[model samples]
Target: MTALTQNRHSPCIGICKLDESTGFCLGCGRSGDEIGAWASLDEAGKDAIWQLIPERLQALSVRVRLLPYAGGELLDWVGETIREGRGTWVAGAPGAVAEFPCHDRDATVTRGEDELTAAMPKARFRLKGSEKLRAFAFDGDGPVVLGLPKRRVALPMAEVVTPLGPDEAAIDPEFRDHELFDIGVARRASRFCVRTGDAELIAALRAAEGRHWTELMAKTGATIIEKSPHRVVETGLARIEVFAEIPPPGGTSPTGPHTHLLAEFLTTGEEIPAALGLPEYAAPIAIFYPGTPPA
Candidate 1:
């Protein structure tokens, strides 16, 4: 099938206003380059970016309040708050619908339009028309509405809270390396869920905490179920301690403190991607890992 024939629909809304402070278009939640390069990109690239939009929108649309309790990582604390505040929703393919509560068996869940179903366990349902299959859940108390297209994707996820802001945004290079970019991938996907109001599917994300991204991938088998609430730290800006290496002695002999060189570029005075050695149109996160570990 042609590329256009196989994929879902385009996500652009045509508003096209770029937000300079965040480097994302206020309308579509995409970078200028992404908007310009949309036609040239393959379906895979489009899908990847489509997945990232919701997270960006979530960060921009939602209000993040720092939890008062201090201890452990902030993301972990946020995760705990989520688990305490909401119920758990698990996402998985049952191989056959028989494994789950069918419409005939459970009146609460009846199949809706275009293979969409409603009232499943924990208020979760499956979504169709994508290259991959997916599902979602929501807090029973709030309006059971899903957000999309217009920018607002969904309500506050019961189990995950994304702390969004320039000060709260940033990447922990150490943690990123530990997950090997898998968490990075999952973070975007989780944001998509949060934006789209897929609570049950997001609830499934709780399982990935404290585990390596590879392990989570193995456990889920590429079903698009991995999740982590911590990626906001990687996405937004925060006080990141950029360490630098001490140069060798003037005599051309290596210094005793020389382990490795780690350099980070930052200008507290302004927010510009170019200062960080990135294209003017690139995402602020495009230059996230610039240098090595400090000596």
Candidate 2:
């Protein structure tokens, strides 16, 4: 039988240490009980456990290892790492495409004295110095090294101005009178897009977007609707509802579309925002602007 037809088995990667807090095996994300019962578990039970592993692994903290390479050695090590299938490569910049299961042919690394740059499709890294290079590993999927400047500064989130135009306003002359409509409007005008108080989820969304937004959505099994000016992305973890081509509150024209993220919980198929007991419009924890550098 081919690899695709082969039966599934254990996920152990040999680094079988258990996390104290979560009681899960660090390498395979299986609970101690799960591991002990794995051999006797039925196929359906195994499948159920496998379905939960991704979210469990995502919940764990990422582990980073600082390699000992310096100067020109950094460049050589990067090439060798990719060739050896160490991990996927992620460009340091926001909105940069990540190279998952990166192959040597799909990556190019070049160096000049103390600086280096690695280029992959739709992703590029420009490093001012190689002294501070490090590798990031997430859920054992990486030792992925990134080229970044020695000193980096955090940029503030840019303001998104979406004035309600006449056409949009005409949709509902009494929209302001409706609380739900006002909530949606306020969300669009707010600096942040994601509406959640969960710090962990916020951090995960930020890190995931920083590495690769599309990849994160795909990994989470998100359902995406790519219709212009009105796109929606819904996943088990979060939901993003976007409204684009908005104009000024009283204006008549439409402008380019912008995006925002909305977070809510679901059970079966029903939304349960009240489960968190958060206001209809909680303070945004994270905002995402596709094709634009994260703010």
Candidate 3:
């Protein structure tokens, strides 16, 4: 059956604010340069950036949750009938403290929580086991908000924390079902541009050499830098390729021209055909890394 598809668009939220510390936008998780040049990039570039947003947001959310609580005060308004009793106090810097109401001229003076603890050097809010203070009120003061506000939108914990692993082709064969993985695979499968500049290696890879040349090259100290499956129309076939950059070994600074290390799968099409028996679930057509060519 003939297929019909519509054009794909970008994932820009427009609420762009670059966080200096993380170098990611608070809303879109894109670098400032990426945001500025979004319109000019091809589909591949846009897809690459889009696939990273969810992972970035998950990391940022975790970081925000673990930040120290800023110090707050207990005002005079929170007190009931005057009674000399101890109460718990919290802050990011200072540990927990036992605070007793000091009734002198019907006035209350606020001090850093750290002052009560000899070990603590700065004022901070701390909580004990199964204890959380959503809001704290002073005897004569307004309620001060504490800790990170609850996340309005819930994120899937599994997707947020779980990684796809080093080799996408072998990591989890079933990951495509996941939204994050699906988007990531779509990006890789759809990308048309490659980062490598070696034309010789590119031509060799395009030719589909019959023999597993990467294994023969590996004995010479070559290594695999990156490897992934290139879908049809992206790399011309459903192929798992090992991308490597080989620089001349010994006293060489990679300043001169070099060959790219590549290993193509034995089979072709939308899925890896099981007919070819190979180790590590892949057949190495060519292999190269940061070293001189073998023999």
Candidate 4:
């Protein structure tokens, strides 16, 4: 019932997610900081994770599967959608799409079978008589994200990438069973923290904002800049946001970090890197090139 529910045990299930400032997922049963601090927690400290589980499970009631598709299907993307090939999300745009790894390589959220494809650019995808979709590029055991590997322990694997779209919250009313893995969700700026300071770094960010933003999101206009307490890797002159949802290209604006863009990453966590150095202002971070630049 409360944090004191000892005998029955809290629903933590071993995954302890701390607040990002701490490198833990109060949700996933891991600290936002995965480095030294988490490694240092003793059993007693670890057992307290038992207390947070119930609160998190209550939140999972809204989890949905992130299904990947080669072309736009009857499905609507409730969270985010990645366009893999060169074509646009128009009538028939196909290269490879699986609700999961469709985004740029660095932005992969989960492992899926890339089973579908569009025959040509602007070729609307057809679920029937279409190319296959597999989550990974390789025939077997495709790619795995380096930092956060898919939890070795498998939970229920629901079939989301099938004919039906992710069940809408309005229609399904009951969705406690399906939960899209919130991998890197914390790294999102709105979902986590973003630090700013240092004239050059800030200026560079502002400049980026002024540029690609319009191209990233569908609409145009700048969003306010905000600073927060969670500091990921702050050394002398720089800190960083680990993840972000860059807007799509050519919606509005001058082209740069769109004010409405969602940026998420780690800060003030136990896993903070020591070899950290300031990010070079010379170019955009990985978010800029979610896929290979048009060459």
Ranking by lDDT: 2, 1, 3, 4
Q: Where does model 2 exceed 4 Å of error?
A: 1-65, 83-86, 92-101, 119-125, 136-151, 154-295
lDDT of 1 by residue, 1-295 (tens): 1122234344543456788778787656788888889888887787778668766756666221111111122223223322333222112101100011222223132233333232322222322222211111111121111111212122222122232222211222232322211132222212211111234434444455555434544664234323322211111211112111223323231221111111132112122222222122212211111111111
Model 1's lDDT to the true fold?
Answer: 0.29
Q: Residue by residue across 1-295, what tens digits does model 4's lDDT show? A: 1122122212222334455443445434334443235446654554565345334433443121111222222111211333332111211001111111223223222212321222221111212111221111111121111111123212222111111112132111342222211112112111111232334333433343323322312222232122211112111111122212333344442121112222221223212122211112111011111232221
Write down the lDDT that model 2 would get. Answer: 0.36
Root-mean-square deviation of Cα positions for candidate 1 versus the true structure, in angstroms: 22.6
Q: What TM-score does each of the candidates earn?
A: 0.25, 0.28, 0.20, 0.15
In candidate 3, which residue ranges exceed 4 Å CA deviation?
1-7, 62-295
Assess the local accuracy of residue 162 in candidate 3 as a C-alpha lDDT between 0 and 100. Answer: 19
Q: Encode model 3's per-residue lDDT on 172-240: one tens digit a residue.
A: 244233211111111111211122233443333334223233332343123212322211111111112
Q: What is the alpha-carbon lDDT of model 4 when measured against the actual structure?
A: 0.23
Give me the runs in candidate 1 sitting further than 4 Å from their true place. Answer: 1-5, 62-295
TM-score leaderboard ranking: 2, 1, 3, 4
Name the candidate that leads on TM-score.
2
Error of 1 at 217 (Å): 57
